[model samples]
Target: MEHRYLGNSGLKISEITYGNWLTHGSQVENDTASKCVHAALDAGISTFDTADVYANTVAEQVLGDALKGQRRESLEIFTKVYFPTGPKGHNDTGLSRKHMMESIDGSLRRLGTDYVDLYQAHRYDYETPLEETMQAFADIVRAGKALYIGVSEWNADQLRAAHHLAKDLGIQLVSNQPQYNMLWRVIEERVVPTSKELGISQIVWSPIAQGALTGKYKPGQPVPAGSRATDEDGGGAESIRSRYLHDDKLTAVANLEPIAAELGITMAQLAIAWVLANDNVATALVGASRPEQIASNAEAAGVTLDTGVLSRIDDVLGDLPETDPNKTQSPATRLT
Candidate 1:
């Protein structure tokens, strides 16, 4: 797998990071999850991303158990804080000093590591003071709990404030994780340029638009039996249905099949390579429910799409992508 530096920091993560967002503890059995993790390692992916909110902290334990024997220094494990975990108590959410301070320790213990490579704020906490949040992150870094700091789904202004605060506190605010794919370009307008100015790179998730870009969901056909569109229990069925499941978008996405065929790669690989073409994108996070899925997705790591193929992709999906910069936002209030 190819590796790229996260933001301006010295930390280099696999260009295709294996993430267990919905699959590890919620959507798949533990044994299957471990097999997928092993497949990622075998495919040369060293970075893993998870969140405490995923399956209420069960995902971290599953990932930890899967990666039990690897040399610690060879991995870059990332986890996030924000949203409720553990009984959904009032104090169980947000980025307050109490929550962040306690969350890091819990995360480390669950991941079976003394320190994480990157600790991220899963969302901007509208309820907590930014200073308090950054201070808590600074304390986590100084206490040797996490080496660097990051945030997910934060907007440009939010990133600038936290970046300045992190600088003042002598900590590196390195990356902002966002949903970026051929169909979801919300971060491109303001977030990307602002992050570039602040020296923060993007660790993008959902590069395939929840498998819509994989060309598996046909335009007028019934929903695939085992695809995410049919997984309403613990998967992303709702979002996939509401966003990209319509016939028009599916037809547009289908137009790219010939492009993928010409390149001798799957549509998923084409989707992933599209995101990596951006210089500001440090990594594209991919997840899988099966071991072979992980191995197949890893092949997108080094694939490159030139300007013509990129233009063809845009022409195929023109005006279907979400580009509203205001769409990138956290909850107006805490979910608890």
Candidate 2:
């Protein structure tokens, strides 16, 4: 896989990162997850992204086991904090010092690692002081618990404040993880510019818009049997509906089939390549339940879309993509 420096940091990560969000513990069996992880490694993917809250912390354990026996230095493992992993308690959530300190230890124990390459704040903590949160992150770095720090789904202002604080604290905040895809351009308006000015690159998720851009969900057909849209218990179907499951969006996506055919790639690869076309995007994160999915996505690592194909994509998906800066919102209360 192709690799790129994460923002201005010296650390280099794969252009296609394998992420285990809904699949590791909740959607697939452990053996299946291991196969997928092996497939990623076989495809030369060196970066893996997970979160402590994924599947109530079981995802980390599964990923840890799957990654066993590889040279740790050859891989970059990233995990996040800020979501409640245990019972509801005053100190169980948020980016408070107590929670941040305790969460790192728990994540290390579960991941079977002494230190993570990157530790990210899963969301902006509205309840905690930014100073307290950043100070805790600085401490984590000083204690050698994590090497670099990042944030996910943070607004431009929130990212600027944290970036400034990280600089003052002598910490390297190098990346911001956001939902960026052909169908979702919310990060393009303000977040991308602010991040560029701050020397931060983006590790984007859901590049296929939860499989909608793959043209698997037809415009007026029943939801595909094994697709994410049909898996109500997985808790991702609703977001897919609100984002790209409508007839208008599906029809737009279907119009891209000829384009993908002309390019001699799958619609998924076309979508992933589109995301990677942005210079500020360091990596495009993909999650999979099966090994073949990773293989297909890894093909998009070094692929480039021509100007005409990109224009065709924009023409087909015109005005359907969400690009408003105000859409980058954090929850008023900490998510449990």
RMSD of 1: 0.7
Q: How accurate locally is residue 82 in candidate 1, as Cα lDDT from 0 to 100?
A: 98
lDDT of 2 by residue, 228-330 (tens): 9877886598899888889998999999999999989999999999999999999999999899999999999899898888898999989988888888878
Instruction: Give TM per candidate.
Output: 0.99, 0.98
lDDT of 1 at 66: 99
lDDT of 1 by residue, 219-254 (tens): 889998988989888788999999889999999988
Give candidate 2's TM-score: 0.98
Alpha carbon deviation, residue 238, candidate 1 (Å) = 1.3
Candidate 1: residue 27 lDDT (0-100): 88
Worst 10 residues of 2 by lDDT: 226-235
Give the clashing residue pairs of candidate 2, or none.
none
Position 58, candidate 1: lDDT: 98
